[model samples]
Target chain A: MINKTVATLEESVAGIFDGATVMIGGFGTAGQPAELIDALIHQGARDLTIVNNNAGNGDIGLAALLKAGRVRKIICSFPRQSDSHVFDSLYRAGQIELELVPQGNLAVRIQAAGAGLGAIFTPTGFGTLLAEGKETRHIDGKDYVLEYPIKADFALIKAHKGDRWGNLTYRKAARNFGPIMAMAADCTIAQVNQIVSLGELDPESVVTPGIFVQRLVRIQHQPAASAA
Target chain B: MNKWNRDQIAQKVALDIPEGAYVNLGIGLPTRVANFLPPDREIILHSENGILGMGPAPLPADIDPDLINAGKEPVTLQPGGCYFHHGDSFAMMRGGHLDICVLGAFQVSRRGDLANWHTGAPDAIPAVGGAMDLAIGAKKVYVMMDFLTKTGDCKLVDTCEYPLTGIGCVDRLYTDLAIIDIHQGQLLVRELADGLTFDDLQRLTGVTLTYQPAH
Candidate 1:
């Protein structure tokens, strides 16, 4: 039947060991899989290395997980924001580690891992501090720095709809990192608003194919106020 | 001397954008350029978080938490706009698909090297974001910043002291006192603020300036 549906958020996040590299899909709060993150928090995995666009916002979702002392490190582009006080405080106290990569490099490196590429030469951070200690090349009078792929142990993502086969679609800007994170991880767990029949999802419109996604769990759409 | 205010500087930058150009305005002062874009021209705005043809801020009634820009602020989408994933969105920037990108900077060297992302302070939390990609990949990189810091330090200098975003990437610099172009390592003054002369602009800037006004 090729059904990959999981019963509960806890079951979906099961077997996540300590020190696992996890990719949480989101750009700010847009596509963040808050429910799955909450479940992972309750599941009590420690020393996680998270990858996302921002650190956290206003003590919820990723911030809550951080507050629970579950994360050891984070690799992201922009970690500082107005509401990023949780990360800000922890970072100042040196309780957590941070790897600040250029946003384009962060995206393409994850894409490279998913695409099965060894490395890529990008001009983004050439001759800058970020490119220091990295291999650089001059191609056709242009300088480029070598960047490697970033793979993950698991990816937690949010989607608008999913089928039993695990095919998924996302809404608006909420689709930011979900598709790529799914492909870059060994096991991609998705939380979807609705679970539809196999034939209900149009084959052509599937953003994350069933092949990339491993498990799908349906979540009720809670009001925005309760999301935090 | 009467310097150009923030909005006036943005308006000046907006005027230089050609018709039908695809532009990415960095957060902060550069975002104001969107409001002054020529109404007759069809300029496509790109947000790094995966949106193209971006419009202005949405009304409170129409705000959607799912739809936000790179700054985490709610925004609307224009007709013919589309959403994409982060990978494809960054690809658009790094692949040279974008025509212009306006950014804010802390320091810009005479050679057009950009230093905006970090102050190199040991205590500061460094966040690079897409600034480096936009600086190097856009066909034209325009920088909008104050000419001097609050402490009276010049931002346009012979050399940048802070960590660089990109090397030799900036094309034009729009500051409060003058509009300058970086041509083959030379700072060419294109226009000065009202009541400000070339000598006045030179005295304020940290580097040598050449007087080359646009005809």
Candidate 2:
């Protein structure tokens, strides 16, 4: 078993040196760790390889890293190319690299990575770009595509509330990426709006088990910060 | 009933929306389409939150506390509308089951890319919600917004200045001044609001626009 140590969110996350791989919990922006992202931005760390759902809305979450020119490559389900076409321009300019993963396949990959599976077969991308350049296998007279597991050194996520024991609850869209990523990272650093004591949370309300969390930080959103 | 300005835009966008087409109205203004649906036509409304038989937003007094859409907003289910798991709803979206998805836009490019989630503000709540899935998973995407920015700059741009949500996924645009299509990497004017001309739209836009007058 891996040895354990205690650290604050800042200290635990400081393990992420330059060129570290990070798996952030968020689908688009729903489950993104805004406070932690802000912390990373303030640190101005660079050369990150991030795995996420949709290279989430820019300059707000992971996009802040993009804006700060910190991330070097991104492994995600979709690339950001809408309003800010600069992402495409940057990719074309080789400013950063993108590894496109199918949403279903990506979800399964994170699951497999967390489970310590080297790779697995999925039917999600039987005939799309996801099928190209990957191992293929057939079962029951049909084709299946091979997907590799992805785990990161650091996992950044947000929780609606967390206990000192590390159990968590997510509110609404924030629920999407948190559970999946929390289980898949080597170390998870969560920024929660509130922190309660152990056993205070109902069993059913704990979306992510305490086992996955290494450290928790209570970061209150100042009311002015959340105003639309 | 007095219509909210955003609701008026939703109604205008749905006025000629064809019958028998499966449409997914986005949250917020687009959600108002359910209230404006024409009884003479059968336009199936799909809510990402997992209701297929979505009725219009109920009158406040008629609201059922139990009935809600994927957004968790209270809704009135239509007679034929049914509730399902969110997974099933996303299946309908990712499975190419939608005919059209009308979403609000932060910025739309000449090529019809949509960027709606982040406003690029330094400190704000960053939530994509379902915009990414809806933006890319739907069969076709349409954006609804006014022609110019609050400062009066055109939102139709040569390139989106905001962080993008989907690339090459948008097809049509319904603005207060014009109805346009993204064709071959250009915004082609197809129709216009009353008293609006092609030149007027061009003056209000920041991108190079092509005009295709309706016959």
Candidate 3:
């Protein structure tokens, strides 16, 4: 019985101390582990660093976590959007730090962290201001900038289904960063829509294999009273 | 001459796209190009958030909570549409797999330099997501924007003052006033808007231009 199922979101996300580096899986709210995020909020971990694609949207999920002053910094590709007021206010006020990365670079950097690579050379932001302060090298007459891996202490991810052994499958585009983030983190906690018995998940269809996941929690879709 | 409306500009850009091209319609005005794409043409739409073969905006009832473009707007998946991991999608972009990518720009230089994702203003919000990859990776990079800023300053400049998205990456520029091509460091006029002339566009642009009508 290779069951990795935890009793609750809080138990699954336990041992996340302050000043932790956490990777959140999502593009906006799609693949976000809302239950895990809510639990982290209630657990009141502070001074955390978060890595994701975007900053946050509306006042729910990651936005709520940031609004609660839990996050000390964010490393993301796009931190500015119409719906991300919380990040906007905090960033403008110099309360929260931001490390803006290019989208492709962000994805590959996380992938590198998972694959045990120290660094990678990508051509995505070669001549731009984003490439400033980074090492640049020419390979076959084309410029490539060096980007280091982005590993995290814990990864909070969302999935459509997960077996007791932690084999995970995501829904549609919602699978954006979940699989990569799971591999890039030391302990990956997945909040899933359903938890099945071992051998229930089709190994062929498993997007994130049980090897990358450490714990799982069946999500209860109850929205919090408020985070604003 | 009356400036082309946003939809008209999108329609013009849509007309120039060839059949069987794989295109990534960027956020903002470029996203409108999908609505104008001819139904008979089979252009695959790619969104950087891992969606490919995307369709136009879905109706209220047909909106799928899980399916969305990079802009986070709900969209329909075409018959052949599929989604993948973000890493794989970006590999397709940076690996030069896309045929074309249409993006909105703040400024485009005579040498086809792009500067769109940010302004150097102190209070400006910095958001550089996938523009750099698209600019350098796509086979053809097209920019769709107004010829000039609202205050009447030319967006097509001799040199970009803002941060560069990619070095000499733009192939064609589709603006309300004209459609121009950047060839060998020259801005070649392909088509002028109705009631606009070569001299008038040259004056408004404040840059050197040569007229070579599209055949």
Candidate 4:
């Protein structure tokens, strides 16, 4: 009776509106939910503000989404990479906006959103150019910069396994931002390799609890191109 | 002067790391340090993406798309390794849980300010991943880079002209020509490449240098 598994990828991404702030989990392509992103592309939500570690790699997934011209802004720590040509061009042509935060700040800010903290004082960017124009505080002899939480309307993540209850477990380094993003978003949509039966996943090992995830879709296979 | 090659510099950095040290190697040159780490030492490598106890690059047959380093390259997880989320991963760096972090830099001021993330070029797309956190968070920040730019300008400067990654965070600097330590705003020469004199090192560096070899 507590099923959250959706029938189709379209249904999983349904109800996402234009101008929504979306968090896509991944550090590069490791945990990127390519299938869910492809579905979102088809869903046709425009002017999205995306939050991720990198913009995209090569001409697929987040890059394909960016190439679709649906994103208006990207809030990420690093958007420039050797294969990030799509974001690079879009950024240079003044087609999209970028808010570059330090990697730790990005993670903690998202964590802060989920944890419901008003603001945090982190020493990661203290006294650096990134700290310029931001609030600063001296705490116990060390300078700290004030950063706010980054809450998203939706979070699209990939996991190794999940149940109908939406409890999830991630594999290896692919777990990157999935767990925290699931908590920081209003609606967390997850794509998993398999949907195990109830109580199949060990309660102790469940990374993202059912309380955080809203929808789950089992991706039977990864697209060959995206897998590489 | 018999300048040390990149691998030698990396090997030197590896030699400095003690056993049981937890180290994070930045992408590119810093990653080379891993190859030269003493076989006897049990050094745990941390990747900012969400892996601890990271191993070297995997063989082509062992490549797993899901398991990659911060550079997005396929890597192996060492025994006793663990996977974590970005929140916990960054927390490890920002919480000073890391013993050492070696990073690549564009410029490092004599005061130990780091400038590697951005060149301040208006046209350049600035992407600063975990550089700032590693710069400020690690107990010892070791920078590995070329002593001079390709065009013959010193990278070690009196003051960083580009956008800073972190201020006064670097402890030791390992360059091709010499190894220097930043202590209380003094650039103390630790070791120089064979046949490289103190004056020769000073002539190449933009900042003043003091000869104080490590014991």
Candidate 5:
């Protein structure tokens, strides 16, 4: 059995280079691989393209990463919020680039990459600016716009529990984008709260099978702090 | 004339939602409908961020950092509520599993064209999220917005000049001044705020509206 565990967060993110396209798994601060992101910020990887649900909720976690001035581009669904001052400034100054994908399209495009599909036509953005320059076809008398797979070089994810083999389960809504992002990346590093011995995680309960995971690191919990 | 306030508009939208309906409420004004839904009715609310069976907003202390709505505000889930991945949730949306979707709009054409996401303003930030999906995916789309912009321009237009979110998708238009239905390529005035006359609505709307009296 391949032992995929890494001893430290820095070791887990060791291979990430500048200009890497990284997929981050989280909705707001929940299910974010915070320690790993901090490690990357410390590692000083620059000109990176990040994919996530939102730009970053507050001035911590992924948002902190953006504020660090390391990201070159962001591809996400919702980018601006009240707490996203870091992104707001960077975006307005043209210091960063944004690929604003519709939320469902963002999900399925990642799913498509994992499933080995080339492109999928969705009716979500048919008549909007989102459909501009995309191939449109009328199927069954309904219009759909073509969207391609969104594959990433690396995926950083947080999971509630993981076994030695890397089979994972999530807590509540924390599972939002982790499973799909895990499958959509070339190398997936998971930060889990706990790691159980093999066979500890029920096969039926595993949300992300170990096959999609490449490495794992454990994250110690701290008292919940005020959100950024 | 006494026009409906924000909550009043939300209450009117809630009255049209039937029991046991699975509805997705857009952010902003449409989110207010959740507060006005009849308590006896078992309407399953959905948030596009992957939560189904969504309940009202949570108090400050009851806030769970993990649970949030499409608007990214903390929310509570109903007893049987569950969450899923964004892909599955969107499949439920694009596959037409939702009973209705109430959304806020910048403009809704008489032909039911929806243009809510962007205004084409040079300085305006574009955030289109799931509006496009919900606009076209839900079984029916009910729009809730002020009848006119803060600048006092009527939003109910003959044609949408802004970029459209969906083509011919709006089924009903609920505004502060009136509740109108789109039928047979015509705008039918169903209910009007008290102290407003048909001619008043017509002059305010800047469009032709047919009044259908209740039986």
Candidate 6:
């Protein structure tokens, strides 16, 4: 059923409980919900475990959440070459937990959760230090390694265009984790630049259908300097 | 010794590839090496989208609409190639199963530090992708990059200018001018790509390149 579109970011992101397992879309700040993130920060939601492809850059994207000391743990596939001062500080202080997976594994793990798969095996980190301590299983006389699934309580995404009913369209690399995270999250919220009526979006262009999305908020752009 | 250009450097690197190895060719210039792998070699090409035994870029008429690489470029699979679930393909990557991962580098430090993720911009996307995983995960990490960025700053440095994808993960640095290896905390100048001298390499590199042909 098409639901009421909320008026403001805070209202849309309200009830985003503390310690929510939030799966944020975007590969390195692309296609991230800037408005929802700001709302989450302003709301002071703490102890979040964000499953993101990339944790934004500097103070611009999800990295801001880390900088704000809002997140509790991070489960991800990509670890930045450039270390965030906030992340390093948090890590050194043991204030937060970090689990790093391979990029490919990151994508597959979330998909596995959405598909209800418990685990799968591959040859990724076989002989290296990565294989140490992990259960190594053999199938058909071949060495296969086991990797588990990752899921989340909320999925926050940025869409180039969306409908009040929650259908979404993402542009370019921005589409990276949004669709899959939408499927894996319990409550999916989309912060969009353009909100249109149903049937306005081309079926081919709709990456995440409305069925997966629960809330939609339209974001009005504010200049970078004025953004919190 | 010959004066090697980008193509020659690509061929030299391709020549070093052992038979039956599983290799991932990175984007841009490194992608060209797909043409140089010996056809008779029993190699398996792995693509991130879950294809194995990939042949090379396909002919226009032979293009299968369904076939492509991770970069979204059209490609061809070998005669016996198979396509599996994309999840399965990544399992091969993160599981540390690949023989080699050929990648492009923005910067490589002298101590074999790899920084190929993002330039330092506040809003710039932070972090490296599968590149980091492949860097540490692959048995061998081969970095393919020009010796110098457009600003004439050498990409290989004492400390990386960009973000680091992996700590001490790079094994070999293949360039248009020379090939370098990291050993005992020193940048060992292995072999010049061809016609390029140690001094020429030093002139281009910001970091010191130690030459010990006898050692």
Tens-digit lDDT track of model 5 for B1-215: 99999999999889889999999999888999988999889999988777899887789988886787777678888899998887888998889999999999999999999999888888766778888889999999999989999999999999998999999999998888888999879899998899998889899876799998443
| Top-lDDT structure, candidate number | 4
Better of 5 and 6 by lDDT: 5
Q: Tell me the spans in candidate 4 whose CA falls farther than 4 Å from its real position.
A: none
Off by over 4 Å in 6: A140-142, A222-228, B1-101, B104-128, B132-215
Top candidate by TM-score: 4
lDDT of 3 at A125: 91
Best by DockQ: 4
Runs in model 2 deviating more than 4 A are A1-9, A56-58, A81-86, A222-228, B1-215
**Model 6 local distance difference test score:** 0.72
lDDT of 3 by residue, B1-215 (tens): 87799999999989888999999999999999988999898999999988888887789887666788988888888888888898999999999999999999999999999999999899998999999999999999999999989999999998899999998999999999999999997889999888999999999876899999997
Please give the lDDT score at residue B35 for candidate 3.
87
* lDDT (Cα, tens digit) per residue for candidate 4, span B11-45: 99999999999999999999999999999999999
Q: Which pairs clash in the backbone of model 4?
A: none
Tens-digit lDDT string for candidate 2 (B1-215):
12125666677678857888788888666776667778899988886544676776678787543355545456676677665433455667756788889898878888777777768775432445456667766888888887777898788887788877676778988777777888777678887777766787787766777888655
Candidate 5 residue-wise lDDT at B205: 75
Task: Pull out the clashing pairs in model 5.
Answer: none
In model 2, what lDDT does residue B134 have?
A: 73
Encode model 4's per-residue lDDT on A1-228: one tens digit a residue: 999999899999999999999999998898999999999999999999999999999999999999999999999999999999999999989999999999999999999999999999999988877888999989999999999999999999999999999999999999999999999999999999999999999999999999999999999776575456
Per-residue accuracy of model 6 over B1-215 as CA lDDT, tens digit each: 46467788788778889998998877567787787887778878787655788777678877543466655466777788875543556667666788988888888888777877667665442434566557666778899887777788888888876766666778888876677887768888877755667887788766777876523
| Stretches > 4 Å off in candidate 3 | A222-228
Clashes of 5: 0
Residue-level lDDT for B39 in candidate 1:
94
What would you estimate as the lDDT of candidate 1?
Answer: 0.92
- Superposed by TM-score, candidate 4 places the C-alpha of residue A210 at a distance from the truth, in angstroms, of 0.8
Candidate 4 to truth, TM: 0.99
When summed lDDT is taken over every stretch of 10 residues in candidate 3 chain B, the lowest stretch is: B57-66
Please give the TM-score that candidate 3 achieves against the real structure. Answer: 0.97
